[model samples]
Target: MSAKDRIAVFPSRMAQTIMKARLKGAQKGHSLLKKKSDALQMRFRMILKKIVDTKSLMGDVMKEASFSLAEAKFTSGDFNAIVLQNVTKAQIKVKCKKDNVAGVTLPVFESYQDGSDVHELAGLARGGQQLAKLKKSYARAIQLLVDLASLQTSFITLDEVIKITNRRVNALEHVVIPKIENTLMYIISELDEMEREEFFRLKKIQEKKKKIKAAEEQLKQTRRAMGIDVDNDGPNLFAEQHDEDLLF
Candidate 1:
């Protein structure tokens, strides 16, 4: 490899060991990410189904409400319009509580219709049956909007959250995890090569030391046989006689 392409500093043995541990941790994290993605996807599908169904029902509810309002309009004064005026801006207090799903909250709303002190003339009709039907239809429409609005909002929120979560999971599964693994493999391979080189170097040094010690012993034996005093660096007649008497 070119100098510029190669790594400037090699990792120590400890670093390679740490990388192996990190690889294992990354694998575990990848599995958890997969589970999270699956769960969010499942939730998305369910919410999508609900939104479709609710919309379909909402259309029918609106149609029935329109027809009912028209009937009431023909029978009596503009009572339908007045009821709408009173109800549209009415209080719709909602209390939110989170469910098991992540990033999702359920909205509980207070009923807007007033029945206790409401004037019967407010939902006036041609007859008692017609008046009752009009009131019932109006209530039905209000309830539908309440139910549909809450569910639709939740569906939209879930869709956004799921999109973000899936992106992260894909990054971990397809990009981040792979990069970490590649780095770990490279570190391990380099560390192995360094270990082998160090082992060979130590072996050569040990052999050289052994050879020098052997040569020194042989020289000492030769000096004694020749009646030379190696340490004193001199030959002596008395030493020669002493060497002859000494055991090998």
Candidate 2:
């Protein structure tokens, strides 16, 4: 592979060790993100189911509320203004909470009611039972609406979360992990090449040492064959001179 394709690091055993560790970490991260994506996708499907069911129920609840309102107005003669006048504060409220699923935080909307009565439902009930029925029907409709909204919101949020998580998983699986592994291979190859070169160099040095030792041994053998001391003898100036008295 081209040098640019692999990561640039000093080619050494230490660098190889680090790259192996990085590869392991990448693999681990990929596995975890894959699990997270699967979990988020499961939750996404559940929310989608809830949204469909809630929407279907919404139509019925709203229709019932409309019929109840009509019945209440016919029985009590349009008492909306009277009920509004008595209202001081809202009784039913929506409280928001967070739910964690597969490391993702999801928003949960809950409907709640205060301890006090809702407006003048009791006094209005005295006019006719239809007003109380209307109250219950509309409350049911409102709760359904809140539930639908919560489901839709969670659905959208989870979709985005799942997309992001899947992207990360794909990156690690296809890109990051491969790059690290390739770099590790490169480091290992470089280290192997270095070792081979070192071995060759050591072999050459030993060969040269052996040649030098053999040359010295041959020189000493030649000196002993000529009856010259190899180490202790020095040059004798008159050793080759013919003696005059011996010649007469």
Candidate 3:
């Protein structure tokens, strides 16, 4: 918005004081937002780095898990039967929590070992050794997935918060601050114009008083030349001149 459009027009000392206070507040807000943006940006970079590392690690874990599953299927004539036997209960459970990073709360997922002996039953069958190895590999994959989920969630949350903070900072720096400063200049200029007008008005009044005083002094001089008393509290020259003209 333009400065004039953004500012309120109030040309008075009270308005000036209020505007100054508002300007101070805007400046303080801008400073705080700048600091907040800086902090969030720092955290965003850290989270981004972690996400990259986690993704790379996830790829490796997924590949290992796939290879282990294939080996288990080759060694155990019926790997599907083993999976069915072990499908009774989950061995890992996910718990969710919140973590605060630079004023932004992010979700964190953790995996905990659940109470289930399904893996032990899977080992009771043929090729139980390969089945066990496959189970361990899958367990490692689950743990990595949980960690990756947490990192991904935190990364997205931080990115959004950083975007919002940046918008606020830019608005204050580009729009709000300049508008307040423009309004302040307008108020000062208006007050100065009022002062100048008042000075000119007073000057005119003083000049009119001086002209009146000069006219009264000239009237006194004329009456004195006609021998009329200057301070007499009576009808003066104009009346006396009228009387003499009537007699003639």
Candidate 4:
């Protein structure tokens, strides 16, 4: 997935509650992955550039060495015998280790200069000055090859790191983040629906209670009116009893 692409999902109650947490986790993971990926890419480019430069230098050194050797052979009148006897290889020390880059460990190479050894081409009794010149040219070529080899090794390391970084970036951006977001949305939606149902149920109960309270008030008013009527009738009955007693 493109790094710029943002995810889209339905909003929900549980989703809302957990979205912040999930998003934060995803964002943190994504940021780290992006940094790693960028680092790998940068390293790869740098190494590739070095390799190109070293290769070019190597080509030049090879040409110069070949020209020098041809000159020596033409002057000596023995190409094969002279090359086989005179050409000497220099010892190289290559130090290698793993380097940490954006949490990914990769190989790195370093070259060290060792002490030089002198070798005579043949028993031709060559002059000291001529031997020194030939040795210098040969040393240049060997040094160039050493540098090129180091660059090549670094390029290989960068390639492997970049591949691993790309895979992790893809997994987080396309798979892990999406799954967490989906789960969050589901939970939030369910919670919101449950809350709405509970609110409706509470409102119904309140309305029922209000109706009962109004009915109880009406009953109390009716009882009070009946009591007033009874009081008035009691006074009238008392007056009638007084008249009857007087007549007796």
Candidate 5:
């Protein structure tokens, strides 16, 4: 009755057939899930590498952006107020799409420019060169941030999916399939025992029939030797009349 010992199944040929089918299905499922786990692990490693590289670049990108902002500030007065006044709509946008990897759906983020750059002309009036440099540095930083976010999200998702897949694989491999096989072995052994019992019964019946036939043949031979009728139509096998036992 233990879960690992055997599955709850009837001990019959039909039950054995069913268990075989179930074992096949479990094995196939385990194989597919194992492959899926491998795929997810691979993706997780790639994402981890990307995150590490992106993080390493993050500090430098942020430093460059800060230096550009400082240079622009020193060259001219506060330009943030001017930019805030001119800012109306977003020129940069992110769109999401589903990416499938070994049956798992992952959301992929992509950044794109939706509209023309707003600051193309702002630098023409004052600190033109420094403002342009600052804009470039910040744009680079934003792109890096977007990439990092995408990598981190994928990493977490893959990690969770891999764990689930491995659990399923283990269950099918170690528990479900083994239990089904044990049930099959039980069914086969029971069937073989039944067949053996039937054979023994039939053998006993045949032996009894042979003994009956031999006794009838010996009786016929004894009647003929005693000079008694032995023909099938002459008399019964058991003679009842005798001169010595007759009394009138």
Candidate 6:
């Protein structure tokens, strides 16, 4: 195997156990990441759909608001002063909260009117009716704008999170998991080789032992056939057997 494929492990059962544990951990991590990626993808699609719908509504609201402004300008003969007089500290307040989606936190914005109505005396004189219409149109436009902003922010956040999640999933599936499996295979192969080597060494030792035992038994038979007494003690048996064979 190439150096890159080889795992730096001692050829032992302990290393095999460690590698198995690592493989299990890696698989668990891959499963969790895959789930996270799927969730983020689902959220991303929902946010994208919301953005599309909000943009369409925003376009219509903006067009209506623009036409109302034009009508108000024509009827009130340039009511810039009146409009400026009503302008005060912002009454519409936007508050943000965090939403958790698939382990990702996203900011959610909500807008509400915080103070007294500013349009109470907006059309007190001249084109009161037209001024009222303009104010309503602009209010709708502002509401739509806020909605669109929230959707846009969510869309962007989901996009980034989806991208990051996908990268992690791919890395685990392609790189980390494969490397771990390769290392595991390598360890198993080394262990098997070591076992086979040990078995072969044992077989050779057994064969040598059997040959020596057969030779000693044959010598004992020959000593007995030559009318020489044999003993259980190996050294004495060998000496007496040798002396009798030499005399014959």
lDDT tens digits by residue: candidate 1, 106-137: 34333464335344555433544556676677
TM-score versus the correct structure, for each prediction: 0.73, 0.83, 0.83, 0.69, 0.86, 0.88
Q: What is the lDDT of residue 5 in candidate 5?
A: 97
Best candidate (score: TM-score): 6
Off by over 4 Å in 3: 1-6, 74-77, 124-132, 234-248
lDDT of 6: 0.82
For all the candidates, what are their Cα RMSDs to the real structure? 7.8, 10.4, 8.6, 13.2, 8.7, 7.1
Alpha-carbon local distance difference test for all models? 0.67, 0.85, 0.83, 0.67, 0.85, 0.82
Q: Judge candidate 3 at residue 216 and give its lDDT.
A: 81
| Ranking of models by TM-score | 6, 5, 2, 3, 1, 4
Clash counts for all predictions: 0, 0, 0, 6, 0, 0
- lDDT tens digits, residues 84-116, model 5? 988898878888888899988888888888879
- Candidate 3 per-residue lDDT, tens place, 1-248, comes to 45454487778999899889999999999898889889888877887888888889889988988988888778777668646765867768999999886677889999998885555766465778887888788888889889888888888888888889899989999988888888888889989999999999999999987887798889999999999988866665543143345654
Cα error, residue 64 of model 6, in Å, equals: 0.4
Candidate number with the higher TM-score (1 or 4): 1
Candidate 5: give the clashing pairs. none
Residue 152's lDDT in candidate 2? 88
Report model 1's TM-score to 2 decimal places. 0.73
lDDT of 4 by residue, 8-97 (tens): 545665446566777788779889878878977887788788878878887887787777666655555454665466546635566777
Per-residue accuracy of model 6 over 83-128 as CA lDDT, tens digit each: 5787878888888888998788888888889988877776667778
Error of 4 at 132 (Å): 3.3
Q: Residue 91 error for model 1, in Å?
A: 7.2
Question: Candidate 2 residues 159-195, lDDT tens each?
Answer: 9999899889988988888888889889888899999
Alpha-carbon lDDT of model 1: 0.67
Pairs that collide in candidate 3 are none
